[model samples]
Target chain A: MHINMKIATKYIVVAILLVGFTSCQKNSRPNYQYMPNMYEPIGYEAYQESDAFANGVEAQLPAEGSIPRGNFMPYEIEDTNEGYELAKASLTNPLDSTQVDFVRGKELYDVYCGICHGNKGNGQGKLVQREKILGVPSYDDAGRAITTGSIYHVIYYGKNTMGSYANQLNEEERWQVTAYVEKLKAELEK
Target chain B: MKHVIYRNLTSRILSLGFIILLTVSTSLSAQEGDVAKGKSLFNANCAACHKLNKPMTGPALANVEQRLIEEEGLDREWINNWIRNSSALIKSGDAYANKIYNEWNQVAMNAFPQLSDQDITDILAYTAAPPPAPVVVDAGADAVVQEPGISNDLILGALAVLFALLALALVLVKRTLNRFAEAKGIDTVIEEKRTPIWKAFIQNQFLVLVTAIFFLLASGYFVYGYFMQVGIDQGYEPVQPIHYSHRIHAGDNAIDCKYCHSSARVSKHSGIPSLNICMNCHKAIGEVAAETQQEGLKEYGVDYNAEIQKLYEAVGWDGTGYTGETQPVKWIRIHNLPDFAYFNHSQHVSVAGLECQTCHGPVEEMEIMYQHSPLTMGWCINCHRETNVKVKDNGYYTKIHEQLSKKYGVEQLTAAQMGGLECGKCHY
Candidate 1:
């Protein structure tokens, strides 16, 4: 009986230890890799931390006045009130009727602008409806009769509480979205 | 009796009229503007740049009329002029207007020539109204959350005590029965000893061999499973610096994944969103609603406002403007492909028009992000073998697709038939 008790206690301890080992596999840390060197890149990966730059980051802003290669067109308007007024009056969509694709425009608009601007541009967006954001004006608002030029300017420079969306949408894509916004405005007016 | 009834009716009518007169007088004394109308107008026009009690892009505007009259010695006429055209007011060299313009970063307030005098009065009345009281969490909810934990422990304790008592009672009963047997002088019969069950089983050679073989096979199977999962980081969930709840943003708010990860549609990688993308909405949303905050605290154990403060710190936003001292948020990347394998986001996202959720799994339901797919080569090959290439409106693949369809003798060609299974497509 004494020998049986000893063996039973030993088995119980082993059972507890086994349970502990399996339960200790944590999800908060990464699993062990067989060969980490092959998995990790040697060259600088996007958003990697490095001492190579002054800022100690892999991502770097382009040098001032240096343009990107291929289809590069500079935005000349300064981010100021006068610049906004000038753009509002003068800026026009470069894409002609054949080039303007409303379907593509709507897709881009839904991804980028529809969260706050609403799917129909009537100011009652999901965010606005949830009261997370407010004071988003409708496209047909009389106080600010947004024109094609004005809409493009606001998107590029981001007037008031809005942020510039130039980085998200390319120049041609912006024109496409501008054309879509005009369509929404016409519908809202009707 | 008739005289008494008549008197009572006349008194009651007089009191009802008096109550009506009091209500009318009180409403007249209060601003002639409708409060409800003012609130709707304020939310529509002013809430973008201003909060009534907090300093947003503009200064807090609570009790502005009274404060302006007392402090600035300005009246309604000056305010109306400023509201209509602040730039014009500043151009006219009004001291207060110029002071405010410089104070708020020279950002010209949009001219609202559309608002008439009555509208302005209504808005001002709304502003003058007292701020709503802070929301108190329901005491019943707190009790409900706490009761289960207490009761569960209490029940367990009672069960344990009862079990111990029963065990003691059995031991006592057995000891008394043995005592009674001893007093009665009854001898308990002893049985002859035999080989133990384990000893008998060991003596059987065939049974021993079978048992040994079973143990070897079981251990081998376990070892294979352990070795196979060595490099694959399936269900890997690392803690991030900021606890951004995908459930709240993607699920509750229904924001598109592309809204933040804009580069996914055109680039090799689905880029981590910059702080500016977060600031776009967070500039206006300084704090979460009370219910949302409470929910976060109870369910997620997170202070959402504190997390927003962390975002502000990283982005260098000092409530009103950029402070120009920013720190990059070190987000731990989750889904990483090995350097040897070639993968492009735009090829799959823009070309195939695959939903982000296809590979990411039900991300909207995930509170903490994790690796959804095994992302092994076999898994990729399996998908390619099953998924037909989307050929419609794809000019680049139309001719090749037709050729491949004829070669395979199938109307729809799978990605594998389109040379997707070639090693050089990914490895080289």
Candidate 2:
């Protein structure tokens, strides 16, 4: 009976110990690190500490390590006039593979540029035909060898009679229209 | 025999004690109230006028319990009375009640006579409860927290160690009891028991077939789970360089979620609020108590305490303070579904008029923004199946509802009926 009591007491003690351990762990909550102001360090560290930080900071700031993709096509005014001349000469076929893109390009061109540049690319645009504007060149006119860059530039930063179309077309849409224009030039040459 | 009996009894008791401890601990941890249901109630009723911490049209509710005890002479009775009918209490010449009534420009606190004592108790409990920990958004510390997908491996290792320790402890205890029995000259039965059916089968001719079948079944399940979870990032908390808190801005301050996530009602993405948006608030609100008081001022001009000043730095605003040199806030993207997923915030937010909390969890409550939704195709489909589309008087959905009702029965056509559950709805 004494041995059984001793065993019972031992078991009770073990149970007590387990309860004690678990109870002690009850109040131990996981420490969660709360960062209330993360943007603060990013701003100062990005500007003051980094080599790329130039003083004139403004809204719509470009992301760090972001470079403009695609070819570097300068939109210089003098080059634009010469570029359009060249596009009228050598650049004929659309560079992109997709036919749907070309079709979309044609639709967009009719909406935006058809009034000034004409439906047939024969320089007899609506404005010129109406005698409201002149000096629109035909696509087959020799002497100018327009690269894709000049045509894109002229379309983006408007030349002569044309206004700036940067607002109307996104980068991809601009590229698509550029492809279609080349197709029109090729068709005209044929 | 005596020693053997004693050893057996001790081991049994110890094991039973351990099990009890585990159960008690598990139960204690699992004493969580339904936060989701609590949130819905809070937003529907309290969110329009009161905030958790900051002063809105009314007083901040961070320590309303303490205020009631210290300031107001009444406790539960007073709160219930005020919620039930504040005007009636004010008429009875309660000084504190009259003062609050006048302070709120005589705008009567809406009488929620329907709210039971239990419901009010839960709300008060939530208000009195300490706020959850803030989300750490320091870009520098992010690298340390997420050392390129190491958490999974760490968890696996810890589990392995835990199991090994348990096995070792069991073996040591068994050996010790055996030694004690031997010392007392107890003749222990050394004969092996009959092999269990499962153990016998493992050594039988069926081994090859069972192993193959088991492996094939396991692999099939694993692959299915993997494919199902392809784009889902349920708790994806990316390591952002900045520790921005949505809880502070949205929950505590009661700032509208749309004020920061302006694109949600208009664009494809709920675009991360730019540095300019941060400037709208943070330009003036610069200091937090813990960061400023504890950390001391770091070398960076970006004040840790002054959240707004950080916005200024991001947008290049000199505090004199407006030389339009703005720097954009480079927020690390957290919830990125693949490009193919066609999630439009306007469709759900503006058209359906769903709250941001429906998909993003309680964003205002989240200290660090995490991908709260599982974002899985299955999860999306499940929600679409379960959730009844809000199709009342919305011009966009009204026409569709009529057409859908003509085809299907008028049992409140769900978003799924309007092609919301189609793979094309979410995934292109």
Candidate 3:
């Protein structure tokens, strides 16, 4: 009887364990309902390609290889009066702003021009006033009416005592300083 | 027969109790969702369009549940519906839906119909939960505010308590049954006394040798791990001199992250903006709030306060003003990796196209910047191992993909395969 009781107890324990494990495994997943029609209907018909007629007359299409107008230009500089004029007119502003360009011009002037042309742009520059350098012209001199082109050219390929600034000042930078020098000339003349 | 009946009853009852305990514990564990998985999902899906505390394409998702509940009359069902198909709801003349659509400039929200409801729920829960209050970065303050939400430590504590109570009950039942058996003059088979671990070890020569070997192996492994992790500061938070809030700048005002860290895409260093850059806006911006005193300037409206005056002092800009003496703003550096670690911000921000917050954490929510990533070699390698290289429609990767496919015979190449996990890539 005791042996039978022991076997019965063991069976009961095992059954309980099996029940527990199975019950725990019984789809504990939270029920989720997926509704396909909840969102907007997507249209695929708009993407299809359609040709209307299969008649004998073919469409006259442009040749596959044709060069369009105004698409080509040589990337070289020519040294002539006409070329220089075109270059001068074509030369774009290197700095975006007048303020920035002016600031840059002032900085450049201080570095290069201030020794020859005074800070105040008067004839009495440090070199001229100190008598270290001579033949410096006052911007208000009677004979000269400097054009923008002349000023640009003088800055590009310097005249008389001045050397060529082609290497020192880039094309656009020379023009900017020329603008500033013109401002100084006007200030001195005023 | 009586004795048999008694034994069977006792066993059944014991088993039932064990089963009940196990069921309860399992159910409790199921209630808490995985936060790490939620974080990854959030980064992948939501981070591009939305920030936690800042406005992007959508409104800031910080405390999103509360906002939805109060503002939109939304429950969990409504949120799930909106995430799946917002345009459909808008078309159906939902008043709130139309308002949100118009507010966001009619930009179509991406449909996430594939995401399970449980996943959406977990994401919402993460959004609602306030981040752990920042650690008192200063060594002077030892008070660290634990992160808000169901902490693992708390869960473990509760489980421990429950198990302890169950153990006590079991002991009590055993004692009562022993007493009953004794009273009935039953022949109880006494259980053999358990051998003490030390005693057992001393008795068995083989066991002693095995134990020694195990100890040596464990210690060696632990030492190796410790050495590997020495300089890695995964969660390093350093105190800043000033409480400059990225939340205010990047979040509230919607300032572009690149505006301040401009060199992020263009240069090796995500260069700290010079004081001149700050002055560009700050010169006109002045004090954000009237609460702070206006520094530097003497006239109440015209003069700058002491703090702004410091900026003037740095750049040598006298407030008289524009005396042309400008000084640089000396901002303290926050995110510093080792010299050997070659992390190019441009490569990550521009080329790979990672969000700043991936490594920086939720910078928009931070009052002061701190190093969020441990920036360890392992952390980097692990990320490279897991993250797939973004190759779709990128011209740079077009040639690379062809080569990779030929070598691996796979359509996709992971970041690790693309030399991201190379020691030289991160180091040197």
Q: Model 2, A1-190: lDDT tens per residue?
A: 9999999999999999999856633322211212324212333221223544454332235576565778544333344334554554544333448543876687567645664466666665554454333345555444233346656766676543344555455566677878777778888878
| Model 2 segments more than 4 A misplaced | A1-190, B1-203, B207-212, B290-309, B323-326, B396-400, B421-428
Q: Each prediction's Cα RMSD?
A: 5.2, 31.2, 35.8
Write one digit per residue (lDDT tens) for candidate 2, span B98-123: 99889866655655676677677667
In the range B84-127, model 1's lDDT, one tens digit per residue, is: 88889999999999999999888888777878888888888899
| lDDT at residue A106 of model 1 (Cα atoms) | 97
Looking at model 3 chain B, report the run of 10 residues with the lowest lDDT sum: B291-300
- Top-scoring candidate (DockQ): 1
For all predictions in the order shown, the interface RMSD in Å is 1.1, 27.5, 31.8
Evaluation by lDDT, superior candidate among 1 and 2: 1
Cα TM-score of candidate 1: 0.89
Clashes of each: 0, 25, 21
- Candidate numbers sorted by lDDT from highest down: 1, 2, 3
lDDT of 3 at A137: 53
> Residue B52, candidate 1: how far off, in angstroms?
1.2
- Give per-residue CA lDDT, model 3, range A1-190, as digits (tens): 9999999999999999999856643332211113333311232211122243232212223466654366332224344344444544664434455434676677556545655556665545554444333334555544234555555665565433333454444555566777777778888778
